[model samples]
Target chain A: MKWTKRQRQPKLKEHIKEDPFVTDEALAALFEVSVQTIRLDRLEMNIPEVRERIKDVAQKQYDPVKALPEEEIIGEIVDLELDKYAISIMDIKKEHVFSRNSIARGHHIFAQANSLAVAVINDQLALTAHADISFKRQVSEGERVIAKAKVLEIGTLRTKVKIESFVEQSLVFEGMFSMFREEKKIKEE
Target chain B: MKWTKRQRQPKLKEHIKEDPFVTDEALAALFEVSVQTIRLDRLEMNIPEVRERIKDVAQKQYDPVKALPEEEIIGEIVDLELDKYAISIMDIKKEHVFSRNSIARGHHIFAQANSLAVAVINDQLALTAHADISFKRQVSEGERVIAKAKVLEIGTLRTKVKIESFVEQSLVFEGMFSMFREEKKIKEE
Candidate 1:
């Protein structure tokens, strides 16, 4: 019996959602497909394998706001093509365990969201002129957190962006960021 | 010449501003005293050194909202303990560097400030339901960032807090946070 492309895709999606964190070998066994096929499917679905997903999440969380060093960034794209304007992150590595007595530290998450928001603007240089954030939940190491940013309003001089961060699919931090584009120098001035 | 108790104590007030972040070495050298003496003076003045201050800042910036893990906090209490509900923090360390992209990964700063706002509430547990933040300037590592949180309004189920985070004696992030509080457990029918 031949499996239709439409049928196979839905089946793969269902399999992945059921076990969002699963190994390629396990998936290959369950689907009766080669590891290469499983990998190809995952790529098509924008879903990396468990280990790769974890690494992607961690690396994205820890990715710096800029590659260059300056007193401040006028406007630098950190997560280009993602259109995500802000970021939030956990400081400890995934190997660490959660402890009630241990605080995850707040600035790490806020900085992540804010930097992403700053990076999303269209300009050669943009600087953070103002920011505000609220922490909703405690985040621990190994927990998956994602930052979501939206453009609220954009103007010639300033653009406003809203950012929210979630850990384990729960909202943990929220913020609004504003960016100022550097003015161009006139040739005659 | 006899020196009075007031005269013997250094005029720390003159040298350090309210919510100031100073290094032990810097303080010691400035006063022409031993590091031990500076430490003792810091204790008396309720001022914390860079490391301790950073920890205090991180706690306010990074930790979860509903519960606080016990840890020794540094930084002098600069504002009046308002009866209406408020908390303030100063001098966030490496985390600040990340938020302003003064370093990298800047979202942590917003996370810290928002967490502190939630932690300062009088309720047993407070969860941030929504927030808006504005970034005013870039904050670097080792710079003092002060967070001031104030309750804007309170209702039966929700409370709103306004927070402002400052670095290098300048306003950097300002935010409004809305929180959900569970005052009593729901009874099952």
Candidate 2:
């Protein structure tokens, strides 16, 4: 996405609009300009620096766990140690449950756990190869669901992560995820 | 579309997939039949009740702003003070705007306001009691809509808040929300 300065500042804003975690250095490289020029352009345009942009995105209500801002992470990560462990919390509102039963849907619990497992990987480019998940118990609205993820093993091209979710210390869901982390070019070799 | 019970069966399936929020009463009225007749018609067609249909739809999509559990909320909140005030910002995307007109959907604005009103309540058990809302102007995708909410009054069981949304300096939406809060209590004893 190369752009002349005349065209780049606004385009720079749009790129960040789509992914606020993008660094100025990456923007500079993409625009084929010096990093300082990207910084200056962002400053002139009143866009915050990358870190601040991420923080601003984080501070929003229902702001999600955003390791990959484009990935649909359904919860908020309060703690993460890349590829080692991560934890997130999702509060179930009335909308999260079946109106007739008031029981939270199973997939929401899976999404929270699966998303955390994927988000905890160290690689910049990673994808979920497959996930094994179980719904141990029904969760209800007004409950804060906490999901914890631990990287069990890291292979050359695959990483293993386990996620467990609890509400008030009782297990409600569990998932094991195998993630793909190798680059496509490297895999071709 | 006009249809007898036999003709409505398959069409009912399609309508609920598109708008699961449609109630039995509404469907009955639309189909010019008694509510019980609608129930029998639904049973004959093997369609679940409205609540189940909604849950099914929610599980398959990136649904949020979840009044109906089929629409997505596009913002993050920078500030919130339960039962008093709140602030959030939504970056409109291509999907948020109409392709032909480039105007964001009216329901998205309403969702942002209604959800904020419910979210800002101090109680763990709160819902949108009612909302009196209006769109002040059409907003385009790529615009950041900043919504600020203020509590107008607080009653024993209900709180009233006003929300005004803006893109730049222009007002795009205004809403007065009445929210309900209560204890599950006559039983917490």
Candidate 3:
């Protein structure tokens, strides 16, 4: 029995399982094939596309509980959906405080909040489309940081969420994010 | 004259010239010294601290440019100012565009936009405090990206900037960044 490239493709899935975030180019290089060929293999293997993979990895890595290692919570989610939106509040850590220096790295905090916002959405998959953020105060590394998010609007194709991250009752970061929810289709009889 | 360990220390300016973006850990490892020792050297050299260094490097590396080879742009800006910022549209040939999987990696666009937003600020140094970004459309590998930025608000110690990145006329990404601009003080007579 002769094995064709198609017959050998399932093995790629195993490699992907080992590193789901690996790129098609890497796979192509490894298999001595073109990137388009590797992509075809990936599509056949039911692997999510690169964009999907990124959101998935970000969702896992930026899990609020994991991202905020030294912080404690103060508020609970009043509302959330499975479509990749969530909201929560926690005390800021002294070590997490912001100086001119720390604020410069503010994306960490925004990423965390945005990740949680996406996590609570009702869809099985969601990705950020856009965001507007306003920072009101400097937060200390160890100060208590309060976070809150709400679905401002949900459309048939898109969803908009608002998130607020605060420290010591002062608003440190306020954000509005537009998210794209991958809707599941129903087969019509 | 014999060179002692103290004399062997790279001149701060020369070290920065070698690679302004070199991490303290990398510098330490290269110089056969501890991270703390490298930091002290940086301090004595009037270089910003580690976090500051990261912010500076990240900002300068992320800015937008009118036109130039991506590599040349990246190379020209090396170590210009510890806190210098600039932005250039990411072309297809640049390494980070692919290495970071930006075309497929959803957040790389945001990362690049965020980095450029921080980089274009005028403070002798600035860092991203927080940013909210929206990805309007998926940018492809060969697309021409435009990163536009302007100061939204400038506080006594902190400044906010709004950055909108577009691919042609389409708004591909938009972000609002809060940065801590180091204010140089003028001594009173």
Candidate 4:
């Protein structure tokens, strides 16, 4: 419970690794140190902020995706709690639009939601079995689409996710996806 | 009906307008003229070939899509038979790729299938109720994806469409879409 700075730093690093989403304040309490000490320790260890840590964990944790590869996800997953909820962000760029109109292609929007649906499942193999989707409005280039997916139902072989994408305050797309998983078991953590 | 060149040209225009997908061979047989004559008539009247006509019709028709607008469909619909089948062609250009990898985005592919699924329905208002999809292979830029959608089942409120997309002979993507329509009524042509 009490250790010198030299001894605490290694344990702190391991703690953060085990729970990357752990906050500095939580780490301070766990390690019996000031929050400022945790921050200083993190700085010395080259650990990033909680937000960056979440992104890094999201990027590195999926082994790509439990369903596929990590690079296959359409957006940068900023927050993910597998089989519970996930949030991702995609900035519509020039490449994402129609050259003639500059309107963001609908698939880009769907992919973001679809991939999130897949990523949120706590399974080694997750695939979309069905999706009920709607394009609520047109998304143009230069907009940042923040997509949030929530697990609506979980079954032995299936899980359902509801994903809503927004460009700021306006809802741009919505989808409900039924996902197929290999089997029902607690994932090894 | 038999008619002079002057008479036939106007009739040909009318016929094409009536059925944009009508083949030259069919037109020749209907008009009792050689295929060459029909071609010549089309040439003189400034009407393009059937392939071009189909593209034009696919583009100009849909108002742009019965559910939304013409511009909403992801790819250019090359051939369509409302409620039966439809096809679209998308040449993956530079704009469709991630600048880092040049792989065509997943949404672009989905949009093509999703839009075709919407376009094939013979309803004034159709929306995707559900879709089961898979990415069979990674598609790169410069490849032309030919997507074909066929109606699998028709219900009073929902219709099922199976869409397969190919890069040459290799299957790149596939999806089964369950689409919802306003009601069971034949679209007035």
Best by lDDT: 4
Higher TM-score: candidate 2 or 3? Answer: 3
Which residue segments of model 1 deviate by more than 4 Å?
A1-10, A13-79, A82-98, A101-109, A122-125, A130-143, A146-154, A162-176, A183-189, B1-66, B72-88, B92-95, B98-108, B166-172, B184-189
For model 4, name the residue pairs that clash.
A64-A69, A64-A70, A107-B107, A131-B130, A131-B131, A132-B129, B64-B69, B64-B70, B65-B69, B65-B70
lDDT of 3 at B150: 68
The DockQ scores of all candidates, in the order shown, are: 0.35, 0.02, 0.18, 0.21
Q: Write the per-residue lDDT of candidate 3 for residues B75-119, one digit (tens) a residue.
A: 123222223334345544443232323442344465556655555
Instruction: Evaluate chain B of model 1: give its TM-score.
Output: 0.57
lDDT for A167 in candidate 4 is 73
- Per-model C-alpha RMSD: 9.1, 20.3, 23.0, 12.4
By DockQ thresholds, what CAPRI class is model 1? acceptable
What order do candidates take by TM-score, descending? 1, 4, 3, 2
TM-score head-to-head 1 vs 3, winner: 1
Clashes within 3 Å, all models in order: 56, 4, 55, 10
Off by over 4 Å in 3: A1-85, A88-104, A184-189, B1-85, B88-108, B124-132, B139-171, B176-189
lDDT by residue for model 2 over A1-189, one digit each (tens)? 666788888888898898665667677777899999998998899999865664565556322332454334568776677878887778798877756458675545665776687678765445555555555667888777888899999877568898889875579877677776645427657
lDDT of each: 0.57, 0.67, 0.56, 0.78
Worst 10 residues of 2 chain A by lDDT: A61-70
Worst 10 residues of 3 chain B by lDDT: B73-82
TM-scores for the candidates: 0.53, 0.35, 0.43, 0.47
Q: In model 3, what lDDT does residue A160 have?
A: 82
Question: B1-189 in candidate 1: lDDT tens per residue?
Answer: 433436535566455554355556566665677788767766787776655665565555443333443331223233423314444455556534533345423454565565666566665555566666666666656566567778878776577778777664568778777766556222211
